[model samples]
Target: MLEQTGLKVSSRYIAQIKKKCGLDVGENFNLPKSKNARQPQCTPEKKEA
Candidate 1:
C-alpha cells in the first residue's frame, strides 16, 4: 500500500503507526491453543528416565 502512495516508510515505522491506531499488526490467531502444541517429541528412553 505504501508503494501505491509512493511512500518509503520502514517496517518499524509502519508497526509504530499501527500501534498508535490500535490495529492488529502482527498477531497470529491461527496457532494452536493447546499447551502441548509446541512440546518436543519425547523418546522412549527419555520418558522412562
Candidate 2:
C-alpha cells in the first residue's frame, strides 16, 4: 500500500505504524511516542481556563 502511494517505508512512518497499529516486531522497530508526536500539543490549561 505504501509503495503504491510513492512513500518509502522510512523509520518514522514505521514507528507510527507500530504506535497506531501496535504491530512492532523487529529489532529496529520503534513506536511513535504519543506525547512527543510531531502534531500540535494542547494542554488542558491551554484548551480551557
Candidate 3:
C-alpha cells in the first residue's frame, strides 16, 4: 500500500512498524490450532498379563 504513496520502505521495517502499532494484520495468534495440523491423542495402558 505504501507504493501508492510513493514511499519506499522494506517489508521488514513495515512489519516492525505494524507490530509497534498493534495492528491485527498479522497471523491470528489467538488460534490454538493450525490448518492441516494433527490433533493429539493418548493410548490406554494395557492391563497386567
Candidate 4:
C-alpha cells in the first residue's frame, strides 16, 4: 500500500515500528480470526425503537 503511495519502506523499518507498538515481529505471526459470515442487518422498526 505504501508502494502505491510512492513511499519506499524497508521490512526492518516496519518491524521496528511494530516492535514500538508492542506487536509481534515474528515471521509466522497470526492475524486475529474474522467472521466468515456476514452479520444480520437491523430492521427499520428496531432502529426506530
CA-only RMSD, every prediction? 17.3, 11.3, 20.4, 17.4
What residue pairs are clashing in model 1? none
**Per-residue alpha-carbon lDDT of candidate 3 for residues 1-49, written as tens digits (9 for 90 to 100):** 3556544555445555566568756664555565876533322121110
Is candidate 1 or 3 superior in TM-score? 1
Q: What does candidate 2's lDDT look like per residue over 26-45, in tens digits?
A: 66455576866775333334
Q: Encode model 1's per-residue lDDT on 1-49: one tens digit a residue.
A: 3556545555545655667568888965576788677633433342232
lDDT of 4 by residue, 1-49 (tens): 2555445555655665667679898773644467584434443343232
Lowest summed lDDT across 10 adjacent residues in model 4 is found at 40-49
Sorted by TM-score (best first), the order is 4, 1, 3, 2
Instruction: Please give the CA lDDT of all the candidate structures.
Output: 0.55, 0.49, 0.47, 0.53
Give lDDT for model 1. 0.55
**C-alpha TM-scores of all predictions:** 0.41, 0.30, 0.36, 0.44
Q: Pick the candidate with the highest TM-score.
A: 4
Model 3 TM-score (2 dp) = 0.36
Checking candidate 2 for backbone clashes, the offending pairs are none
In angstroms, the error of model 2 at 8 is 1.8
